[model samples]
Target: MEKQVKKKKKKRCSKVKKKMISSLLVLFAILLAVPVVSAQTSLNNNVPSSNSDATLTSEEQKKLDERTIILKEYFLNVEMAKAELDKLKEAQSENVGPRASLVEIDKKIEVAALRVEELKEKLPVGLEKIQTAKESGNVSALSSAADYAITEIQIFWDSTQSKYLAHTAGNFTSTNWKKDRETDPYMTGWRDFGGYDGYSVYSLHYNINIYNPNFQTIHHADHTQYTDWTSTASTYPDARGYAWKYQDKGYQNWPIWMTDWADYNNWRQLGWYFFDFVGGKPSGNASFSASFGHTWASTTINSISYPAGFGWSTNSNRWDKGQSKAFTF
Candidate 1:
């Protein structure tokens, strides 16, 4: 009985050893499969999306994207500006009046439109270059395209303002000068006047004509003098019952009778001499007197004084020949 029990125990021990070995094999297979599956998942995750992966650093990529967006915005802005300009042109054409700058505006519009179109057409090329620049990490190429796009957009904006000026407003004009002449003088020998009231006249032009020859003579007091009678033997006796040989002798220096000018426009008053003279005569010799006056324009007059009033005359206690004339021009 004891020997039989020992044999059964040995058989059971062998069966248990075989089961343990099988379990070990299954665990080893699971471990090997786990590595392969994990490796495949990692490779799939790392695979490049498109062969066109950018060589730029993260910061460089960000900058390029920013510039590209800005360029696109510029393109859109320019397009809108062009549309507004076109509308303005159409309105200007329909309601036409004195379009003095219309032709110039049209030419400028054409040129600016062409430039805008050209810039717009080149946008695609610039975008492609930008893409390549980002891929190759070529900062210089990206900068070049950015600079050009910015400059073109600025030019378009400036042109739009110029177009607005030419269409809405007129061209700049210089202020001009104007002149006036006054030819009617109140009296003979009086001068005419000329005046300007605008921009200063750097140059002068004149056309003067004289016709209808006519002349006139008039008495004018040039100058005057007075002298009292003296009790000397050299004095002439009273001839005409006057205390002195000559009561009062009037002397004319300039021609008292003057002729009228046919046509005279020289109205500047270079200089003049006029008189308001008063004199007294004691018992002396004969007396002489004269007066002179000058005038130019409407409000200018000149006078000079020598001897013209009266004091004690040989006959009359007081004598006078001083006179003033009222004139205008």
Candidate 2:
């Protein structure tokens, strides 16, 4: 009986030792896994996980993307509004007629002002979000915002000049006559020389002939080339037709010639003369003045001679011609 009891106690002690060893092994495994799980969780928080079952929150990402897009659009709208305002100012300055057009431009200005205000409201919040992304080292978000701003500025600059041209009708000119000549047949080519700023220039060609009763050409062809400058103010003499004083140093007087009109019969025949003058620079108190006169000799039949004078004033707008007096014969 004593041997059996001793054997039973030995068996229980062995069994208890085996169970404790198994429990210790299981506890050690769990302790090792805890560190790995902690590291994985920290990595997932900072960057996207590669695990097949892992996923980023789509709702949060979608909201961020949408906000970025809206901000970009708002920037573009602001730039566009600024360009429209510039065009409106240019149109008003160029003497584009029709008072009603200005009213329309005013409306456009109001609309642009409203749009700019709206953009300013959006820019602050959008910029804050972009900055937050950058702080977290999101390179893509930073690049997107910068690219959007650059594109908006470029688009504004490109469109502004085109819109200004459209609004002013390319700067108003009086001569609408269309005829084909050696240089420009379309007559539309006249724009190459018309406008207030010395920037525009053109060349004109004309032919005149006087015939005798015998059908012989009495006055043959006369050809001349003229350089013209247009400007609101005169920088150089001989630019376009504007008020300018002849320079004392390099100034050269253009030769003037009158066409013979005796062959044509009217109480008083009209002859055309060509004069080239450089446009004058603008001055605060500057005014335009022009003067021309004619001299004639006494005829054997009547002994009559006279001199005529003409003059005109300059205005901020149109070039108005002054009254011309006729020379008595």
Candidate 3:
């Protein structure tokens, strides 16, 4: 039956797709270990369905399994084509080899992209059919299998994603901070006049190679800033009529190192700054606990002076921090 199905699918698949099928098994094997698709969660991050295998009869379970396998193959076809399309575009942009070679690559890209789009479009048809079966209150066996299939497919997709992104949620790989420290000053103001929310931009650079050549340099703020200021150790927080506080800058910085981005998405940058006040000492310390999915880092600066608020922290306050292991996700 699958032979007949493949024969039919082949007529619609371009030569580019034939090349894909030849390597499909290998790609899927690697996918098991290489987490993929930064857009995976962004595209469809639905929760698992309430329907489960344990609730289904044996025949229903068999049907669900069959549906799951078929759907997985279809999804992988789309993914594989996308990966191919990405590689082709990357190569075309570089204008590698000869002009003739570039032309050929572009044609391949067009073909692969069409395959991706077609596969993606077809995915919803099957899913919607399953939904219709459930909503119609008929075909109890098919409806039961539908819920189980959706849940299984989601699990399968998630498992595939976990392959490359061992550090799930965010796909960027980890890198060390290229130290860019600043000298301590008797700070009394912010780099930017954000009033009580004034802030000085401090950045940690990670010249990262996320293994996947397609991964781009991502610049974003951490989910939350783990910060603590000492009223006893630093200038009086309430003294300035403000309580000490710290937060991400909430925007991208054209930092000095941004130019270095041309080489690699090197310098995965995280923007965090401190702003707050207290009625206490003019100088003390501030600590931070930051995390994104699988990666975590912590830092503390002791030179926090009053009037200047938290000042700026360029390199974990001149000291590098170790990787944080604890993550909620």
Candidate 4:
């Protein structure tokens, strides 16, 4: 009885598997027939088929050809009009045209702009839409507009011509060597170039520093001493430039100063350094100035004497004069 039951169950499972296979076969057949039916319907209805490599109807082909011709003609006209406008500009710049030529050139520029807009409008849609319409051969209601604006470039150039001078003093001497002394001359001057609210500087040459100065002495108690003299300088395109304005300008500009401090010993005890800025902006009257300071100190000892065995007395211990060089642009 058990063996007979098992055989019956196996037979039922096989029958169910056959039914599933048969259903899949029918579905596959229907899918295969769908494209063939669609092609027949497209032919009967006289409509362009979406199937790959399907040929267009005569009317559709004619319409496509007309659009292609229009596109070619507009492209040609745009190129020609652009060329003519450029020629007029060149002629005007060379002073070849009469006064009336200005009016004529302006009119020509307007016409060129209109021609560009017309050419742009011919496509009516973006590249993706244009391709879709071309494939479907249906372009009955398509339109577009063009927006063009003029960008102006204003040039400016100026330099500091006036001579404004300021000075700072550096001098300290003591008999007893057991102290620290410092001299810092904050010397800075700036002149407005004026006339430019916003600008870019392509070239510049400036001079701002401490000049004609004697070195103060730092005497050690044991007759050993080091003369103290040091300086620094800087130039900024826009020192007082507003922060928000730089965001639109697309760059951040801080003061551009000398990286290393100008040190002065016996041989070198004077001008901080010169500046040559190539490209910078914030056009208009730009103010610029520099400041300097110095310090002198003696090493601490048990006891020291002044004006006796120190053996150092010079008239160049003080800064005599401060001057500025000619600035150029």
Leading candidate by lDDT: 3
* Cα lDDT tens digits for candidate 2, 176-241: 111101122222212211122111111111111110000000000110111111111132112111
- Model 3, span 1-329: residue lDDT tens: 99999987787677768888879978888889965533222222111111211244566445444443444344434544554565577577777697888888978988988887787667523343111112223211111111011111110112321211111011122212212122123322112111111111111111111111111112212211111111111221222122223221122234434422111121221211111212221232221122211111333333332234343333332222112111111
Model 4, residue 25: distance off in Å is 68
lDDT digits (tens) for residues 124-207 of candidate 1? 322321011123221111111110111110111112111100000000011010011222334433223221100000000111
Q: Whose TM-score is greatest here?
A: 3
- Candidate 3 lDDT (Cα, 0 to 1): 0.29
Ranking by TM-score: 3, 2, 4, 1
Give candidate 4 regions above 4 Å deviation.
Answer: 1-60, 122-329
Clashes of 1: 18
Provide the lDDT at 208 for model 2: 13
lDDT for every model? 0.24, 0.24, 0.29, 0.26
In candidate 4, what are the lDDT values of residues 1-329, reduced to their tens digit? 99999999999999999999999999999998874332111112111211112244667445434433333233334433444454455455666557788777778777867776676455422211101212223212111111111111111121121111111111112211111122223322221111111111111122222111111111111111222221111112221110000000011112313211122121111111112222332233222222121112221111112111112123222111111111222
Model 1's C-alpha root-mean-square deviation from the true structure amounts to: 50.3
- Residue 235's lDDT within candidate 3 is 24
Report the candidate with higher TM-score, 3 versus 4: 3
